[model samples]
Target: MVAENSTPHLHSAVEPRQTFRRALDMAARAAMPSLFVMFCAILLSAPFGIPGQAQLQFGIAMCTVWFWAYSRPRSMPALAVFLCGLVVEIFSFGPPGTVLLSLLVIYGVAHHWRYGLSRLGFIAGWLIFSIFAVLASFFQWALVCLHAVALLSPAPGLFQAALTIGIYPSLTALFVWGRRTFANPDQA
Candidate 1:
């Protein structure tokens, strides 16, 4: 009788541990996308001596937002997207709200097309993202020009868009690996 009673207590103790572990896993999965984007934003902001570093960072940030928003809208909610954009804007020396607005627009488009993008091939997704990169670059350039009250050269913006489109496949592969490794297997 004592053995039977002790068995129940042991099982109960293990149950709570399992429950806690499951909850922790779910929370980590839920937070991963936003956390990853913020990490990228901070990491890319580091002062590398490469030419066009700011443009490269901004392009990478855009790619991060697009991937998360399209692939896992639930994980990367609008509020998190806003916060990520704010982080990017704070890190970069661009005009206020430029990166934020661009990211928000990207998030909106990605979220809206999430299902379609998910069903489409990688090439189709890349083409769509390329269009977004160009539009975001143009939008940011327009905002900067308006802020400065003078027309700025469009060269940097064009370069940023091209760089972003060029790096999509590589960043996407990293994101896919992260999703497979860290996210719930069923979810991935």
Candidate 2:
């Protein structure tokens, strides 16, 4: 009788620990993408002294957002995306709402087409991302112009779009590795 009573108490104790562990795991999994993107934003925003550093930073950040939003929308909800964009905007020191609006647009579009993009080949996905990059660049350019109340050259935006499209493959590979290594296999 004592053994049976102790067994129930032991089981109950272990059960709560397991439940707590699972909850912690789930929360970590959910926050990983947002944390990863924010880290990238901070790292990329560093003063590299490169000729087109801002554009390069923006390109990589956009790619990071696109990969997470397209591949695992649940991991990167809209609010998380907004926060990431805000971080990028603050770090990049661009006009307020430029990067934020562009990233939100990318997230919304990628989330909308995620199922189809998942079904397609990597090349097809790249092609679609190219379109998104250009569109986002244009959108950002328009926003900046509106903010300035004067027309601005489109060259920077175009170059940023090209850089973003060019860098997609490398960033996507890193993201895939991260997802495979850290994310739950069932979720992947």
Candidate 3:
């Protein structure tokens, strides 16, 4: 209370509580992208109106996670992508190792071809990967058919594949917009 003539020290007078609040804000911002991804997967996978439709839609989560890795390869490490895919596989009732293997393979291919993929811009790259995802799904289905005595039908599976491809571009666009608007600068 003795600053009548002397210049006031603005930052020096700031309370520790304000600094703590600012830190919390920064931390929350940094965490939002991962939180969003987790939320999207859980929400989309939750038991819904149609089970077959739900199964098909689950691929969108995998697509989003893969696209994030593709778009920001330097930040989203291979290990993280693999781990995330493993978690997805556990939640998804498909072949034990198939989804995880496919995801990693997709990630690797996407990474190797990223320079060209990036040059094609967002939607084009997304469509390319969507085609790859459908092909990979069909390959996995073929393996399942070979192993199972009952024989898995390809018709429903192919329909699911087509549905996934049809929805992929729009979902990828949503993720791209989210990444641009909500992702942390440092996280990417």
Candidate 1 accuracy as lDDT = 0.83
> Each model's TM-score?
0.82, 0.79, 0.71
Off by over 4 Å in 3: 1-37, 51-54, 121-123, 186-188
Alpha carbon deviation, residue 38, candidate 1 (Å) = 1.7
Considering only N, C-alpha and C atoms within 3 Å, which residue pairs clash in candidate 1? none
> Candidate 2 residues 41-94, lDDT tens each?
787777776677788767876787788887888778899989988888888877
The per-residue C-alpha lDDT of model 1 at residue 89 equals 84
Q: Give per-residue CA lDDT, model 1, range 1-188, as digits (tens).
A: 78766655544554444466677777788778767767777776787677877887678778888998888777788998898888888888887888888889889999998999999999999999999899989988998899889999999999989999998999899888877778643342
Model 3: lDDT equals: 0.65
- lDDT of prediction 2: 0.81
Q: Return the top candidate by TM-score.
A: 1
Which has the better lDDT: candidate 2, or candidate 3? 2
Per-residue CA lDDT of model 3 for 73-119, tens digit only, reads: 65355776666666666666666777667767777887888778767
Q: How far is candidate 2 from the true structure (C-alpha RMSD, Å)?
A: 6.1
